[model samples]
Target: MSLLAVSNLAKRYRRGGKPFAAVDDISFEIGPAETLALAGPSGSGKSTIAKLVLRLIEPDAGRIDFEGGDFLALSGAALRTRRARLQMVFQDPLAAFNPRATVARVLDDPLRIYNIASRAERPRRIAALLERVGLDTSLAARAIHEISGGQRQRVAIARAIATRPSLIVLDEAVSALDVSVRGQILELLLDLQRQERIAYLFISHDLGVIRAVAHRVVILDAGRIAESGDARAVIADPQSAVGKALVAATPKLVRTSQDAS
Candidate 1:
């Protein structure tokens, strides 16, 4: 069975009394340990798709089935418990974390709430998580303001993994960092996937980033799927006009050759 399957999913809103579909009737499936990227230009509803799967917003129609069970069927207490198995790492880490809280406190909350580790063992786990995201455990007690943008992003990734989720929505998670740091974080995420076999829905506008990390690519255009296939194949040969535009818009794959200087 697929890890996740979305069938005929749709979400909409009204603008000036006109109904607009932010996400149309879209369907896709992801398998275990797979990295599937949803790529598109702005206003294409890729992020809206992410929100639907994560249940940040309810879909107006269709179904989200995870492991053959209906996700939308669960709510309130049941939904809260199911959340531990599916987590999201957002686009901006600085915005994601509370400025007032120490990194340790933020990361520790998931551990405590999920009951993943006892209070006594949380220290060791926090240290391990920091190391996994390429940060020193000593930085755990530091405020979000004290770290580089990259380090702050790592903290968010660490928090997401500390729950040991089966699926992670990396919604433009690496786009905010410096190019060099972005590469490192992508590598770290890949390493973790290898170690834990975590499935990722990596949403990004950067084809370079998508090509580097994704196994399969799902291209969205105007709130609908224009293309979906192997990342290498899709990057090399885009079937749709929108897909071609996305590839052409990239800046000469500078992200890959930036290291040669």
Candidate 2:
């Protein structure tokens, strides 16, 4: 079974007398240890799809199944607890964290909130999580202001993985970092995914990074699925209008990796 499944997801915002669809009839899945990249321009409904599956917003219609449980069917504490198996790495790390909290405290918050580990176990897990995301544990006691943009992003990613989530939705997670740092974080994420058998729903505009990781690619346009298939094939020879645009916008000298093990 797919580790994460989103079927016919639809979401809309009502303004004036008409409604505007943010995500329309989108369906896809991310398999165990697979990276699926959703690429689209701003307002193309890419992030909206992330919010829907993550339960950050209620879907107007659709089914999001994670490990045989339909998340759309869950509610209240059950929903929250069930959803903890999935985590999100936001586009802006600084915005995701509470500035008042130190790095260690920020990483520990979710463990406590989810009751995943005892208070005594929180510190060790927090430190390990920080290290997993390529941060030094000695920096744990420092506040958010004490870190660089890249480091803050690492902390944000560490917090997401702290609970050992099976599926992680990285919504433009590396876009805000410098190129070198972004590559390092991307590699770190891929290494973790390999180690943990994690599924990644990576949303981004940078096709280069997507090429580095994604096994499958979904292209969205005006809130609709434009094209999707094997990452290399679809991105190489696009057949739709939106797909053509994505192909054009993609970097010409893209690096290709083949390890279909």
**220 Cα displacement, candidate 1 (Å):** 0.5
* Candidate 2 whole-model C-alpha lDDT, 0 to 1: 0.87
The CA lDDT at 72 in model 1 is 93
Worst 10 residues of 2 by lDDT: 252-261
- The whole-model lDDT of each prediction reads 0.91, 0.87
- Separately for all candidates shown, the number of backbone clashes (residues 3 or more apart, or on different chains) is 0, 0
List runs of model 1 lying over 4 Å from the truth: 253-261
Model 2: per-residue lDDT, tens digit, 43-100? Answer: 9998898888888889888888987787788899998787778999987877888887
Cα displacement (Å) at residue 181, model 2: 0.2
Provide the TM-score for each candidate, comma-separated. 0.95, 0.93
